[model samples]
Target: MIDPDLPLDEQNARLRAILGALMDRAERGQLPSRPMGQLSDVVALEQQVRARTRDLAEALDKLRVTNARLSQAERDAVGARNTLADALEAMGEGFAMFDARDRLTLWNSQFCAALPDIRDQLGTGLPFQDYVRMVSESAAIDLSGPAERDAWAAQRLQSHRRRNVNFVVPLVQDNWLQVSEQRMNSGGTAVIQTDVTAMVRTERLEREKLLDEQAQMVRATLDHIDQAVLIFDAKARLAGWNRRLREIFAPPSALLASGTPFTQLLNDLMRRRLLGRGNIRQVLTDWVNGPASRPPLGLDLVQEDGTELHLSAQAMPDRGFVISFTDLTRERRAIAEMHRMNETLEARVQARTVELEAARDAAERANASKSRFVASASHDLLQPLNAAKLFLASLAAMDNAPAQSRLIGRVQSAFASVEDILAALLDLSKFDIGAARARVDTVPLGPLFARLRDEFQPMADRRGLQLRVMPCAASVRSDPVYLKRILQNLVSNALRYTERGRVLLGARRHGSALRLEVWDTGPGIPPDKQTEIFREFTRLNPSGEAGMGLGLAIVEQACALLGHGLDLRSEPGRGTVFSVTLPQASAGPHAAPPLPDSDQTAGLLSDMLVLVIENDATSRRAIMGMLEDWGASPIEAASLTEAEVQIADLGLAPDVILADHQLDDGATGLQAIAALRAAHGDIPALLVTADHGPALAEQAERAGVLVMTKPLALRRLRRVLQQVPQLRAGQGNSAPGARRGDHSYWLRAGD
Candidate 1:
């Protein structure tokens, strides 16, 4: 009666319902006896029922097939589970399951491999905690203490539940295993372990190497960095410090051992102003919040042991400040020494500057005094010379007298002395102004020698000394004027110094130079005084003669200007030799002609009319007498006015005109000569001046007149007169008596 299409639960309910209905019908006596026709129908119905039963059996067969399929699925699932178990057992990661009691339930091959010594006990099912203790006690691993082990175990348990624990442990075997644990269920735990010994060893070595490298880098940085480094913890306790810090603060061995309080250390520094004007905590706080609020702290602190330290510190709010202490004793000492040395150097420089300033000031004052002296002396000396010249001119105009010659001679001598002094002073002034330059020219030595002989011959003869000039064939390029002066000074000096014996002037060739020498065989210069002789105002024998002692000084100066070398050789009581070396002239076979003898007397008593215009009557007479004696007609004029009157009124144009340079009317002889020449065209004139001024000579030369300086010599006058071209034969000496009776008689009568 059950529905064959229904599910098992529904079919069971339907079968139950159909059985109850059949029993009830049986109980109800609804039976039918087998009737002959009806019996056949009933049997048919039963057959139908049997057919339904067979259909039901076929349905049960389908259900049996489904059940068999389900059984096969279960078997496959079991096999897969076994395969998983095998796989996990063979894996490098140790797989295990454990109960809540921490008992090892299962372990993989990798776990046994990791702990080979404990491989045989794998199935023993030991507690994980017991295993940890055994390993720790055996020294195979260090878990520190029970507390540490408990912490680790608890962490492992928690990590297992979360499936996050993956850690390794080294065992007796030369490998390590990664142990990962997970809680499988409420009753047990699962663990997976892998052999990661190579990785672990490599990682450990890398870690160690990294640590070592970091240490080395730290040491290198500390050794090379300019700033010192120190580290402290939040407790203000020293944690780490570099070698430089150790050297600065304390010895390496004792640094950590010393339990020195940071506050006490800071107090020492603060007392010394190392931490500025604040407590250590306040300084540290300021540094942390804002370092700009306070000034930098630098201090020198002396320790109890007498060690000095320079301390500097900076704060790191969270961590303690890094304090750097540097030993600065040596540096301080060196700085002190440097400061002292600088002071000494500055003092020396100041002293030297003061000395140099003083020296410069002194030099300036001396120069100023010298200039004043020269100006004053020159003015005073020139005024007297002008007056003497004027008086001499007036005397020369007088009539002739018996004592006139003697009077004129005395005046002449006096004038010579004044002239010499003036000349020397002028030469000295030229040197002072740096105008005493030399004009180098090729001078015929012969003529120079001749002139020197002519000038100094009579002088030497009067002194009873032989004056000779040695013959020289050389022509030298030198300043003729300077050479003449030098030689004159040497000769005059020789004559003055010498009592007897001859004086020789000579020249010789040495190498490419000409050596002009003056030798005197008389009392010589002492060897000690030879060097002094060339100095200005240095006279070896001042008592011997009247001299300014500038002669040899002038020689030296002239020689220097000419670029010549001067040498002096002398032996006391023997002789003195003064030599000047000059550059040689061009070499050649040709030489200059010999100079004419100055002593040769030529053309006496020529037809020469000599006009003598002189302001000094004495000079005019002397000159007239000398000209008449030489057989020449002479005319005399006392002044330019007289000369003009004589020329205009007398209508007398003389062949030669001679004029005195200094006139009574403040007129120069140059003016007198100009007036005379205006009357007589192109007439020869001679300028005679008692003035030793070079200006007078220059003026006369510019006027084309010959110049003769006073104390005029008669010989020089004769020589000058002979140069005149207008004198006719037998006209030179017209009448000595007529000449003497005229100007000479007046000159004598006036005297």
Candidate 2:
């Protein structure tokens, strides 16, 4: 057998010798007794042994190559370690590396040089947290003081686990280190520490110099200001003061020095009486010992010599307070002198005011008397005017020659002028005496516009002017009578002044009001004369015009009474626009306007009986005559008593009763109507009066009696008489023995 552990050459020689013997034995066939199979077996066994030896030789060769490569790698590793050690030693900054397990793997000599006490504790295989703990516990290092050591260690370890971090740490002897940490791809942390002590010292020196300069500037500014100033530290000790404080208080040098307690200084001032008497000392003491945060305090101090001083104290962000004192002596003295002088002047003015008040009272009384006279005169004038108007209307209704007709027409025109002047005077008096009242209603503009067009169309045709009134869809909140009169005066003024151009009456919607504007294309009023035109008896052209220039005056007063806003816009060569603004109202049924004036009174009052009770003889006769001309059977009486006698004794149940408001025996037409309705039935009655007061109208409305202000319109009178039976029927009342007829309805007076 070959020995496997023997040298390769020796083993090969042994194998060769064994193989040679076996082969010779097999080739000689010496032993005839041995079988050929056994000989073949020996030969095969030698072949297997040789194959095993060859495989062993190849394995030895491959092992030798692997051992040579491993030896070379080990040598390279030793050299790289030496190079890393040299590089770390040569670096300017201290460097350290922690492995993935957070164990200190490598560090340079300068890593803990600033803190030599911890140098021995830092080594390979030491945990990163333990290294940080040793450094934080080191006596040589100052982590902003000893109190922050434990916190610094915690922050250091936390930063070591982050990707990148940078911070500065201070050491004893004013040294500082800038530490930077970076994370490696192998999940290890690398820390680099740089000494920044020189740069930190340089910046600190510059900062101290700047602070010195600022302190000097503050000291200079405090000394120059007029107010005395003192600054206290957070501990309430005297920290700073200005020259003015020393001069004002005049305290001893020792008491005013720095480091003195605020209480000590305050007690010295109080003892010397330099500070004002009162609670000033106690207040200062409590404020000094109070909480760090306090509200600002201010007080005025009057000195013994009458010198005034204002003291103000406010707290700062550092829990200190700054106190200031300002002298107010000169200003106080000047104010006192001015107050004395004002008292003297006020005494003189009081005497004068008493005299002026007496004069004003007397003037007001005189004005009131004038208003009464004007009112009485207008009422008395209207009575006779009403008679003449009625009589003239009756005469005009009869057939006459053309020459007589023209003269009657002139007379009617003159009467119309007188009527307008009287009406304006009455309205002016009502406003002057404060007797006008606005009965506001939801007055629709549709019917009002229709009436205005009918009244002005003839005048417009005669003057060859276009008088256009736009259709209105809005309603307004105002007195129906006063509002219509205001618009009428405005329209009349516009047409009269406009020679050959058109006049426009329209309504424009403003926010909550409707602006009723009367626009005219005529010779406009000048800016200066515009105000003058609204004054009574003032006209631009008084020659050819029939008006007494009271149109605009009446409009102004009516608008004022109704509480409507009025505005006028006019230029010399351009047109004019007069706008009246009234509040808009919701849609509602309004009292219908008066029927259009017509001469056709033929069948309206034919065979209709009307009882006329008027006090004025001429007025009663004229009204009775006019009623007769309208084909109505009229009965005349002088008073309500006479009419009652006619109805009771004569058994005259008239279709309608027309009575005067101011009747004989202090009996108003309203009372008369009430008496007749009680005795007879709810007879349709009309009250005619020259007094257009709101009291009479309200009384008439309650009594269900219609009121008509004189001088009355004849056409209106005839129309009203025609519809009296219908009005009576609508009331569900008819006089006994009265005729019933189907007649068109007419709106009652004061509707």
Candidate 3:
């Protein structure tokens, strides 16, 4: 140890040997307090301290490695927990969990959100019973009274106790929810509530559709039956009928309905001279009520015109009588023809049959070709016009230079003129093809006039003309949609022709009819010209006029279809008056009530939720954009199924539905709206269609939907939207819809 020059390895070995020997001596109590012994002891202690420090350091190094591994495991565990929470939050269905103690332990935001009214009372540590009580007291929808709330809750609680059970609950809002409860491994329950309203509505609609198909099948069977079938109730009221009966009797529509008294029907038949030779009163009464008074009866009667009819009656279980009428006129004629045929040649019969078949085939082919050509041409002509209108509307909505804005206005006017011409051509084609038909209903003149006023006001303002619609108290039996169109064309023609004088629209009673008149103080038409004015494309002054003169033609055709009398009076250099005489109808449930006078300028379309089911992307976008400009929330869907998904996903009900008649997938907008209303409450619906005939309007009316024809008039659209009860002022787009380009509709009901 004293020799510094010794080899390093040899020195370290000597030091280790000395330390070991010293430690052994120390262990044997050999180390003394002497300086030399103390120095050796200190040295030995140092060696021992160094060796122990190394061991401690090795242990510390292992502990550090273990700590790092533990930290990573903790991070992974935290990440997993956060991931689970995010997944729960992202679920569309409401999710919640409760521990064995029946206390809420976890829940996604929708868990409480779905409850609506009692969400404030739900949270962790909330007892299941307390939550149930809160729900019973504050639920937005319930079918049971408060008295039964406790009982219902008790039953519900009992159901919850069952492990892994699932059930369904219905909300009074017409919403159905599926509640699934899963037993968690930790003695807890996981609940998932999914909205099944759409599913339930689809099922119900399917069933209703099936029933409708079955009814149609029955109607078709009855229509095809050879014998004319009629049924009268025990009270002798007319009930059942078929096409053959209608053809055989040619009874007036009112006389052949479900509730006409048998006596009245018989009287009408007698008045028409259709009854056969019999004791006038007693015999006919016996024929109608004999099935009830007696077992059954059969009668053969010969009409004054030499037609024979066979009637057989049988009593139904419901005390009604089923009567069958077989026309024996054919049989008698067949007998006569048989006698005559014996003297005829077979060659003549064959020649006549071939000639008739050839004529019929030629006529059918010509009609079919004409119809196809007209339909295709109309669609092609209107498609570009519709697209142009949409783009112009969009451009008009943007902030533009004044001259540019004026240019857009002119373009819009041009588009309107083009559309009108196309529409007129289409209408003419429909009328010629017999594709246009009338559906008679009770139409209130007051409301119809008010709508007319709203529509014509803007046009009148543009021309500095006063268009006034006089008060009306009458309701008429007519097709309101077509009638409105007819009047629109009439009033529009009057406005266009009359330069300065006010256009007056009013109705007057004439016997049992209402004579709706449109008076104009413009240059009077000559008697010679007035007669030809109704002809298509005939105009008195064609110079600087954009009108194609098809308005009067449409009016003439519509009047003919509706059986309305058209009267025109004109004085040279004075004025002209045109009137349509319509049969006045009694005020009934079918009458469309007058619209309330609301400020059209006030936030009419503000804050309204409009679900538009339009297949045309451009039209849909245009409508959405326009509604957005008006501050209405518009939710667009291409089909009913898609609309349903959007409605469900948005989790909000629509106030009104605006749809196009022809949707994709062969589904009508009416069907989509029907499905939505079946799931939700009755929502006001307006159907827009390019189909201009009365057939489309009638179909819409039959489905209880209002028609808004396309190329939609902005003023008319505004007026119709004003009438929708769903629109309310000061509402905002606060749902998921706002981001999806849904705007709001504001309502100004008063002032």
Candidate 4:
């Protein structure tokens, strides 16, 4: 065995030397011989020694490699610690971090720089709560009182536990610090402090500059406006005023400064009576002394020198108010002048109105006289014309030369034209005087169209023009006579103007009316002349073709009277359409068939007894002669007395009495017919009169008398005579003395 104190290298060297010596001796066999057991012990001991040597060598190699790796690891740890320290020192913001257990872990040198009083106390192992407590208590933090400091510490701790938090704090040295905390992924907290003092100072400077500029601008604006302005603060002290206020009030300069009490200025103005004797003083005093949120107030004052001042006060949002004054002297003077002018104008208008009234009265008298003259002239003119027409009719009935007959026919044509002119004039006169009124009737368009077609078809053929009356089954609500006249005028105008092409008379159904249209392919009227055509005697063509140019004038007047809508459309080379719109009406009972003509019904009056009375001798003779011609037995007389005697001597009760409306001695046909009817028991009397006024017609209708205007056509006469028999049949003709009375002496004597 080797000694334990020897070095391992030396012991190994010695063992190797001894082993060599033993091996050499054993191989040479130069030793004493021994037993077999003893030889085996020696080999075993040698093998043991070799095995221990191999084990020792392997352990030594492993120890050397282990020492190399441990050395490198130590160097690496030192380098990493140095790098972390440098990084924390280079950071701009003060930074600190805490571990998962709420113990301080990392910090930069800048940390707690604001709280220098507590900076020395910071360390790696410090708990976050203790760190916040130290920061709150530091004199560097701008916090007051011990209790406030405790509350601040609690808030800081609470903020550090949240996911993310940020706040700003003012430092004692007029500096600002923005602190921000962030949660670490490893369940720690990070805090950052940013110095924001520069930014805060910039914002404050800008705000102060803006307020100064606004004050100057307000001062300039208040001075420029026309109204005097005064501003008071919430404490009822004068806050602002303009130059105009001093000029208007003329108050002492001492009272005009800012902060002057409002009551001082008010009292000065009132004592001097510069504010007039108005309630402006009381109103202003009450509003100023009342609630801050007062209603708006206003007052008007007039000074002794006739100066008008309007004072108005309005509240501001901050419980302040602005009062203003405006001079109203010029405005008041202008209003007074306007009122005076209006009064003068009203008086002038009243005087002019009186003059106009007198003129209107004079015009009315003249118009009345004209109407009377027209009536009188028509009656006097038609009487002789009636007699002459009768004589002409008698001449035509006799056998005469064809030439003589032609002459007579020509004379009759001239007479017919005269009659038409007269009739048109009378119609126009009635329209002028507003005497005509619409008599609405359910006039069937079918019959009216048919009659128009028949009347105009012959003329159309003579003119070589086609006239088309479109079939219409509709009826319309309108005055039958005026509606007929309107359509007649439209159709006649169309036919007259059109040299060729067709004239169409048709109706279209509108919502509640029928638009009766008359269309013609005519030389279309110019647009400018269309309105003129509706004026009297305004003929665009002026061809002198049978018309005096009053047709359209009458149409316009009649349409106005009837309230019919008339529209005309035409193009220069195209066609013309005149449309009349009237309300649609339900179909009414068909009218009675027209009375038969004299030729067809003349025999029906054979052996009919008729009495004729007249004031004009020629009219009486002519009417009596026509009665005989119509196959009637006739008694003729000139007045009521003459008719009674003739009736008594004739010994025949009259079947029909024909009497004139105007008789000699102011007696009328109505009165004569009444006397005769009292004697003859309601005899059917026909009044043949030249007067066609509404009064006479109404009177005759009430007396159960039929009226026919003067210069009547012979054919119409025969028709009326035929109707007399019908009337007698309806009234039942009386025998002589059937119901006699004192007025029936002639009838009593005959009986």
Candidate 5:
């Protein structure tokens, strides 16, 4: 087959080459098969052999690359182990890692140093028990005793066998360590021993600093507080005391400082007698055992040394208590003084009230007495004057010659002056004593001015001056009688003093008031004496026949009573003008009733029957004479009994009755009137009184009798006569009675 056709040497060489090729193939991991018989074929086989050799070389190169990678992996493993050991050494906690057998496999220098005495002895492969045993014997693990060390090691060893364990361990030199162990999945353990000495010391220092700050703050605040303060701890130790307490108690500084026992402080106080120790000790005991918050306890005590103290104590929520001491000596003394002053003032006020009551009673009695005296005097004096006035009028009625009538008129004028002076004095006294209560009424200025004009026109004619009264339709709010009196006085004064020129009585509208003015062209009041003219008894022209200066004063008082304003304007050598501002009112039928005209004598007086009841004998005679002059039949009685007899037995049915207000035998003129009316009929009557007071007016009004004051002209009687109707004795409509003195039916003031 080696190609028989070739030489045997070639066949043999071919076979040896084939064997060499097979050996090369086997060396290069190539399998050899049977060869082909040809040299070129052998060359092809050589080419195939070269290709297999190249593939084998590529596989060898890949295997060499894998070997280099394995070497690099081994180097990396060594580097990683170094890095792990360095990390473990750099850790804050001691590191000790054990294998599943509980023998130490890895550890750092810190782990060995954690047991300072056994540092050289600690290493890998040490059982956890031996390590704990070594640590237990060192000065680092200073347990309570050998028994405690053994127990702690036993308990730690038991914990080490578990999957996890964590605990703190104390060491020598105040050092502390927290030991923790975490079991791995391979049954190995990682133990961490953290040296927590710095953390524990830092926390303790911070706590001490906070406590110091709080204590300082408490002390500073308590020092500034006004009251003395003392604080006790939960153990009843004197934990805090302010500067004020030290000053107040005067105790030794050391005894008052913090950590001082409360019992000791109380004992010191008891020795010093600053407190009743019994009370303080009882309260302290209560505070220590009591439940929760309650009202603070308080005590006020006056010490033996004159120091007054107000003490209060409150129990803290979680601790002992706080106590305060306040001095109250000043407050106590002030309260005592105030009480004393109140007592004194009460006594004084009681005394003053008593005195005031006595004085008021005396004043009331005096006023009543004065009123009685004034009324009595006025009545007694007017009786004589009334008699004289009527007698003079009877003389004048005789148709005497001019000279005789002139002398009679002069005497009458003097009598009139006396009457006016008395009237002025009475009015002044009433005003001064506040006895004249005004009876206010609506006064129509028309009627009022008419009266004033009629009243002063004669005086104006006598003085050779014209009197012109301006007509006013305006009505006013005033007491008509008082208002008329005021104007009468003013006009009389004006006409008396005014010797020439005209005297004008007029009214003008002034705002809501009517200014009733009296203007005269006589000598005006001097500027200096204008205000003086209104005072009592200040006569400006005593020789010239001016009044006793009471006219304007009466004007002033009357204006005051009506609350009207009076103003006077004057210039020396000129005329004076007096204006009264009268409050204007609604004008209608509300004006005051007009007074009867004394000048008119219209009734038939001769046929009329009249009875005269006068208290004074002279007044009765005078009244009877005036009625006789008027030609009226008059019956006379001086007392109530006499008047009663004249009315009953005499069967007198008088057309008119003239009664005096103050009658004899404790009977008033009104009583006489009432008695006569009972026997006779409802007869018209007139009450004549010396005083025009509220009592007499009210009595007259109640009796349905007209009122007239004393010392009046006979013309007033004539005017009264006109009011009575003619009733003759033969008419016989009623019971017949005695008639007055024989007289005609009518008579004027001059008749």
Candidate 6:
């Protein structure tokens, strides 16, 4: 069992030492080795030595195998523990373990990471509650309650069994961490912390965003709407309102104040209530709920400041009611205007209806008057003609006697007056029936004045008054005969009215107009009676006048016919001047030149020819005689056809033609003149009518023809004839001779 290859010195030393010890013992051992008995003792000792060596070797081998098995078991246990620690450190949750004394026994890396501030205390095994108290106190987290401490301890103790805990702890970043606990057999507590910061932050942000959007939506919707909107709390306190409500109820000062009481605001509103009819409370309630269950309430509100508003209200249960007010002042004004317009229309309609009825009544009266006039005229004609016949027969019976001649002259004169009246009446009828026409021609004023001078000179001499014709170079487009008639009537009236005064007939140009003036230094017309003088049948001086009051009326009518206006200026004792305005002719040398004698007979006619057309035998004869006396040849025709024939057959080409408007064949002289002028050239023509109608005169003037009423004075006839150059001067190489005649010689037959 022992190695036998030992060194000899070592073996020898060992034997010697043993022997020496044996001898020392056998002083006690030497005597026994030399005998048979000495052999037995040596073998026994050797065997004991071998046995001891073998037992020592066997003990060493067993001790070496036991030590190897114990080392292998310790290494396997260390590897398993390292794997468990790596698993705990990989978790997101903070993990820690504490002992039954609440001291930290074991803690993973995550626990130290989660609470870095307490990492130095981990190995010290501090109580879990103390660690929580330290975190609460130092980090500003609250963890003071017993329940919280117990809960934390329990969470640590049961950390492995639970996924999360009921209570969470918040960190400085506003992040939340869920905690769980478990208890270990080692009387330690385990804690797990899980981060839930993102979930909690998202939830909170969502709530805030929703509130902000809601507030913005409410503000935008209320502010832009036309109606007023109010929001109130459950206590009926005002919380918010739109701009419309603020404008209606709150002044700028009050709205800007910090905090105004709802009750006080309501009281102020009631004091300034726009509706006066209802109590404030009742009105507010009605506005909130409407009049009927579903019907709206409409009211016209008049504020204390006199502002009118139309209001409509709608209610919301929790949000209060919205009231809309619209100013209606302009609408009320429009309504008033409409009312006035309606009243005006009604008044106009009533006035028009009344005027129509009045016009109808006037027409009926006029018809009655016409019938009466016809009957009276028929009766009057019978008496005058019968008396004339009787006188004529008696004169015939007394022929050859000198007394018979005088009787015949008186009879003739009486019959002539009657005939003139009848003729005037007939002419008036023709004018009324619109049968009158005009023959228009150019009329010179120079010659017209000359003839007037010759005729009125004698009359003026007899009356011891000066009669003058002022110089003028003016011609007009008008009816020459009618213009002469108008002048004759005016001059005659002047002579009749004045006892002794000079009468001057002159014309002056006013701009493009000519004013024919007849001025007399005699008794003037009363201002109040001047207008009446131009009316038919109106007279200012009636005594010693033996004709109807129609002279001035005819003059006025003639002025109107010629498109001329008449103006009168007078004073009671001074004199009267009557002016007739006519359009002036274009200025030229050939247009009615002024006469050579500027002072004496300045407006006299030097050379002119005239043709006289008359229907009545006596009138034609008288006109021809007057024209001849004025040194003017006069061609006569009884009818328009006869005049036309005479004008054509004579080939005389007279400067002026005078014709009776009412011819024998019911043909107007205007038709005859038109026919003659068409065949020849435009010649001056005059129409003689007994018509006194204003409309007839106007028609004659409109046709450029002159109209003269019946019973014409010879002087006026001569003046009109002299106004025509071609008529006064015969159609010859030389001018005709001028003849001087007494004004009385040219006097009308009746005069």
Per-residue alpha-carbon lDDT of candidate 1 for residues 1-751, written as tens digits (9 for 90 to 100): 4556676656555555555555465556465553444545445545655565666678889999999999999999999988887998666466777777878775556664545556665664788766554444443443456776566566654555564455765455455556666655586777776767688567447535643553554455455443456666556666566666544544436444334555555455456553334354574545534442222345566655555666665444344555666766666765675566557766577766676579678776765555445534544444434334434443453332336556755665665665676566556666655646565656657767877887799878877999999977577888667788899999889887777899999999889888999998877887778888888767665323436678988888888888989999998889999999998886233332432232474464365777777666645665676666566887778887777776776676877777766678688877777866676766666676544444555556556666665545455456545545422232332311111111111111001
| TM-score against native, each model | 0.40, 0.50, 0.45, 0.47, 0.46, 0.33
Q: Candidate 5, residue 57: CA error in Å?
A: 99
- Residue-pair clashes per prediction, in order, are 37, 0, 17, 0, 10, 34
Candidate 4's residue-wise lDDT over 408-486, tens digit each? 7876776666676666666676776766666576677886787789779987997789999998888888877678889
Question: Model 3 scores what on Cα lDDT?
Answer: 0.72
For model 6, residues 132-197, the per-residue Cα lDDT tens digits are 655544343334566765665565445434533345665665656666676667666667767777
Clashes of 2: 0
Residue by residue across 1-751, what tens digits does model 3's lDDT show?
Answer: 5354764445555666766776677677665566586666668667755665565568779989999999999999999999989999999888988998889988888885656888777778989888777866756645467776777678778887788767666676777777898888888888898988899788557535643543454466578557898878778788778899888788988887878887888788788877675675576576655434344556887888888988766665456677788888977886686567556887778765676579679878876676556665666555445545665676687645467699778767756766777677777777877788676766768767887898789988877788989988677889765798899998988887777869999999899888999998778898889879999867774312326679999999999999999989988666789999989987554333443543445376788788988887866777887778776889999998888899899998887898887877688887887888899866767887766666666566556567766667675566667656432232222211111100111212110
lDDT of 2: 0.77
Instruction: List the candidates ranked by TM-score, beginning with the highest.
Output: 2, 4, 5, 3, 1, 6
lDDT of 5 by residue, 618-687 (tens): 5577677777767788888888787677767666577878888787567788777787778677777777
Per-candidate Cα lDDT values, in order, are 0.62, 0.77, 0.72, 0.75, 0.71, 0.59
Global Cα lDDT for candidate 1: 0.62
Scanning candidate 5 in windows of ten residues, the lowest lDDT window is: 740-749
Candidate 4 clashes between residue pairs 3 or more apart in a chain or in different chains: none
Backbone clashes, candidate 6: 34
Between candidates 4 and 6, the one scoring higher on TM-score is 4
- Lowest summed-lDDT stretch of 10 residues in model 6? 740-749
Candidate 6: Cα lDDT at 164: 34
Q: Which of the numbered candidates is closest to the native, going by highest TM-score?
A: 2
